[model samples]
Target chain A: MRAAGRRAPALLVLVSVLLIAADHWITLTPLRAFGSGVYGSLENVTSSVTRWASDARRLETVERENARLRAEVLTGRRPTAAVAGAAAAYQVVSAHAIGFGGDQTVTLDVGTGSGVARDMTVLNGDGLVGRVVQAGPSTATVLLATAPSSSVGARLETSREVGLVTGVPDRGLLRLSLLNADAAVRVGDRVVTLGSENMRPFVPDVPVGSVVAVEGTSGALTRTALVRPFAHFSTLDLVTVVVGPGRPGDGAPQ
Target chain B: MRDPARKPAGNPAGRALLAVALVLLAPVAQVSVVNGLGLPGGGPDLVLIGVVTLGMVLRPMAATVVGFAAGLAADIAPPADHSIGRHALVLCLIGYLCALVPADSSAGQRTAAALGGTLGGALLDAALAGVLGDESWTSVLGGLPGSLAWTVAGGTLVAVALVSLLPRRRRFGGPASRAAARGHYTGGHHA
Candidate 1:
């Protein structure tokens, strides 16, 4: 009795140790099924909250624009082409910025279940954030535009000159590289995604950010523009991952 | 039930309850509170700090158990897809390292060990990912400083808080040691 009593704590500890070790082989198989359900519910709650917040902000902007447009119309003119063109350029959906994984490489609580999907793009109200790398039922990993592996085809909204936007992980900055050294691109020019057929992932004309600077090459074939992404990633509270309204050529990688 | 506040020392059942509480509570806290306070890359790993603290105070076998349980909680995170066993295995190593800290360590030493353990484990995890081709060394290294600072800060804060919360026990061979004795000994008979 004494020996058994003495050994009991050790034995219980031993058994738990074995069970924990078992976790290495199994991964999240059984637990994840349950976790997904929990996360799914949370996603609903957060999505609704974000939608309300964004709607309020949208109302503010619209009201201001309404005042401005009224002034323009009062001068005996119809809706100006510039104002109409801007409205037709893009659509916005609101999403909650939910939880993240430990390493921070992945974000969760927004996906196809909440109307997000692969190849669809996401952004903060200010500018482009990232594209959906993978979408699970109720979760997705948004490859942030600042992630090192991220690359996007971009164009200067002013000149319509094309370039590639690449991420610098360390600085949390994005760079736009133009093929022609003397391309008409300049600082403060609007940068937007260069949309290709099907809008495969990103539809054209979404504001990414403004060019912050132009860098000279030691031996460069292309000119690189420093881009300060508009999305304040550090304090991101809400975002919108664009789901399909079906652009003419959307679905595959652009 | 005997006085709930005064359970028999070394009771397997009570210990089991404690371990279970740690496992269940750790991850839930990590998800709800830790992740809710998001920084750039993500929030600090609180469960990792908790496991390291307990492991430092426990026996080798017990530390491993705590490490396993805590790591398993972490492994249940949403991104379990990209890296499954990475945390579990890494935490197991952290538990073992915790046991190696000197038993007579000062609070500062324990705090240092906890911070070191967190940073070391994070680097190991990043390196393993690099080897797996999931990420490049430069990319992982770029995020290293910020991640390390977060882990160390979180660990130190939790350690200080836990120490403050636990009732102070008189040091052995001190003036009040005899009166403060709890009548529990691992390998001795008391009359």
Candidate 2:
């Protein structure tokens, strides 16, 4: 028994090393999916608990926002046509924000069973949240726009100047680049998604963020600006997944 | 304090069950509550702390098994950025090394050792990530100290708790007391 005890750790370590190598050589999709399912369920439970704990504060915030929005509507400042287009064009699947993976990824309670698919866009009431990278049967993973590898086509709402918005993971900020130097880009300019073909990954005109800083001189061939995303990546709670071109049963908009 | 050389006494099955429970719950807490606590760099690695604490009390082999399972659970847990097993490999070594510490060591000493182990594991993880080209050397190195600090703080707390709660018989005194009692009886008979 003593001898066996001495050998146990070595054997287990060896097994762990081999498992690591195996994971790299092959896609452990089934295993990974299973793990995700378990974690996702646990996350769902925990998120609910946290949500319940903060219910009163959240309720007060919501009420204040609702009153502000009502005043905006009464003042004849209705939402733009682009906002309306987004609302009508995509089927929104409501989901609870479960947990974040590292700094750039988040897991959601909804998944393939709820019409979530890879590359589907995720959003909240404020703005864009992320895009789905993996969707399991009952859970999905979203790669936030703030990840180092994430990039989205964006246009300045004022000048309509198009550029690419890429994430700076270390700084927790997004940078917009490749805009024409002559473009009327300035501080506080609203940025919106340029959209993709058939709206698969990103739908057009959804609010992305605002320019916080403009980089380079005025006459350069191209310019870049730092953007602060509208959605609070750290405090995400409820979000909507844009499943497709139309509402679930509407069978794709013409 | 109990004798360090004594074989530990406890229900192996109960201990195994407890290990499983810790492995499952540690990562969930790490992801949900701990990570959300908004500590700088990230939350302390609760799973790593648990492994180290267990290592200090359990036999080397048992501790190692617990470490591997806990590490694997952490790897597969959501928000894991690197390839699976990086954490497992690090924790396994840390557990084995920690188990080698004398069981009779003071709880404070054990906790300090666990903190050191947590720091070492965090650094090893960062180094591995750098070698794998998953992250830049600068980024990995930059984040190492802060991560280490957090893990150490967390590990210290966990070690303290484990030391306080584990049965003294299971941890240090059982087998040695029995052996000593037997020796005393034989000597008296001979006298």
Q: Show model 1 residue runs off by greater than 4 Å.
A: A1-93, A101-108, A247-254, B1-43, B57-62, B72-76, B79-82, B99-112, B158-191
Task: Report residue A216 deviation for candidate 1 (angstroms).
Answer: 3.2
The residue-by-residue lDDT of candidate 2 on A46-121, one tens digit each, is: 8888889999999999999899878887896866545545766677778977877654678788877788888988
Q: How close is candidate 2 to the true structure, as a TM-score?
A: 0.84
* Clash count, one per candidate: 3, 2
Q: In candidate 2, which residue pairs clash?
A: A101-B79, A102-B79
Predicted candidate 2 versus true structure: per-residue lDDT over B1-191, tens digit per residue:
12223324356677677788778888878777776665668767778777877777676677788888898888777755466787788888888888766555566777778778877878888888788665667667656767787887877777777577655554355666556645543453454
Q: Write the per-residue lDDT of candidate 1 for residues A166-210, one digit (tens) a residue.
A: 887667679999877778766798888886566657767767788
What lDDT is obtained when candidate 1 is compared to the true structure? 0.62
Question: What's model 1's lDDT at A242?
Answer: 61
TM-score of chain B of each: 0.70, 0.77
Ten residues in a row with the worst lDDT in model 2 chain A? A245-254
The top-ranked prediction according to TM-score is 2
